[model samples]
Target: MADMSVAAPRSRGLSLPRVNIRAVVMVLYLGFLLLPIYWLINMSLKTNSEILGTFSLWPQNLTFDNYRTILTDPAWYMGYVNSLIYVVMNTVISLTVALPAAYAFSRYRFMGDKHLFFWLLTNRMAPPAVFALPFFQLYSSIGLFDTHIAVALAHCLFNVPLAVWILEGFMRGVPKEIDETAYIDGYSFGRFFVKIFMPLIASGIGVAAFFNFMFSWVELLLSRTLTSVNAKPIAATMTRTVSASGLDWGVLAAAGVLTIVPGALVIWFVRNYIAKGFALGRV
Candidate 1:
């Protein structure tokens, strides 16, 4: 009894707290991924001189002038508005066009169906550069140049195919019996699709919209090529930071930080849907 009590006290004193290896690794991995974003924000708040001269994790002389310039300047802020306009338009158009096309693809059987599906995918596979010149020329000739709709339409060339492909996958997973049953219960195709079918694949729609939004928002080549002034996107505006003096590093950093905000907010809003969409959709 005396020996047992002594050993228990000794063992208790020597014991160590449990360490979760996976949790530690995850934290370290996340920190590594976020380090650049943190540094960008850090640089945005510092002057160009400080950014170039110092190698600090945090800004020494913090200033909001960089952000203030972007927020206050019409040239800078309008870029954001223009980008939102086209990106939203593109997403809406892509989903609208893709829904019926995808449903047709998922539910029908016709000649060249496989070939047609492959053709749609080929458009997505083609490089954005391949169509850039053509789009530029076409839009310029049609008086659509430098317009938000021009960019939105150009983006649809890519986004619509991808949206169709993704939505088709989700639609395929859904049983045809549901469609039959809906028709049996005196429902029109439009009513059944709008009320019943669409809800079933809501996750897929969210995922498609998220991807379309991101692509349209970040597409520099087409947006820059097609637009000049009135409909210039923020991606195009960021290039103005380069001049005879050199790159405006602070303003550029601030712009980069601001650019990340919309995408991040979108991811936050549709995060759960994206997760489920991937799990259920063909992706």
Candidate 2:
């Protein structure tokens, strides 16, 4: 009985150290991830005087003027609208095109299908710089340049491929027998895809939408190149702060902070779908 008791305590003792180590690692990782965000929030609350005068961990005089400026300014708000329109358009175009392409890749076998998949992915691998000039001239010639559609369609060049790859993985994880059964039950391809496959992979769609939103949200080069003052995105506005005098650090920082809001709202709404999406796809 004494030996048995000692063995149980020893086993627990061995587990305790591992648990403690994992806890410590997790704390450290969380700190690493959150520290920059903390600093940004901290800086946003400080005055320009305080920001330039001293380096304090906390604000000397907390102010809401930064947020006030962003909220009250038409230019700032208009940029938000431009960004929203383009981002949504880009996501819609990407997913609509990708869904059918991904379905084809997952369900059908065709000549050079695997090679085509790789080639599609390679579009994403190309640097944005390489495509910027061609995109600018192409859009300009067609009179699509400087419109929200131009930016949205340009984003599709990269986003569509990523959406296809991600959704394909999710679709492939679905059992082939499900498709066979649906067809056997007199379900047409359209009905089976809409009524069956879509519901099963709704989480994947959410994940793909989230990714497309994020990439297009933060993208600067394509957005800046595609629009001038009339349709300039917030990212382009951020660059205008750099003048002969210097960078408007305070306003720039404030704009940077505000830019995070839409992405945050998106993630907040879709966070529930992330776990299920991963589990379904094993991705």
lDDT of 1 by residue, 1-283 (tens): 1133246444534434524666788999999999999988999999999989988889999999999999999989999999999999999999999999999999998899999999998988889899899999999999999999999999998889889988998898789999999999999999999999999988788888898998898889989999999999998888865563398889998999999999999999887667555553654
- Taking all chains together, each candidate's TM-score versus the true structure is 0.89, 0.89
Evaluate candidate 1 by giving its C-alpha RMSD to the native, one decimal: 9.1
Measured by lDDT, the strongest candidate is 1
User: Residue 2's C-alpha lDDT in candidate 2?
Assistant: 14
Q: List where candidate 1 sits over 4 angstroms from the true fold.
A: 1-21, 276-280
Candidate 2 pairs with clashing backbones: none
Instruction: Please write out the lDDT profile of model 2 over residues 1-283, one tens digit for every residue.
Output: 1133256434576687699899999999999998887788888887888888899998888888877877798877688889989999999999999999999999899999999999998998989999999999999999988899999999998899889988997888788999999999999999999999999988788898888998899999999999996678988877774463286556667788889878888889888666644443444
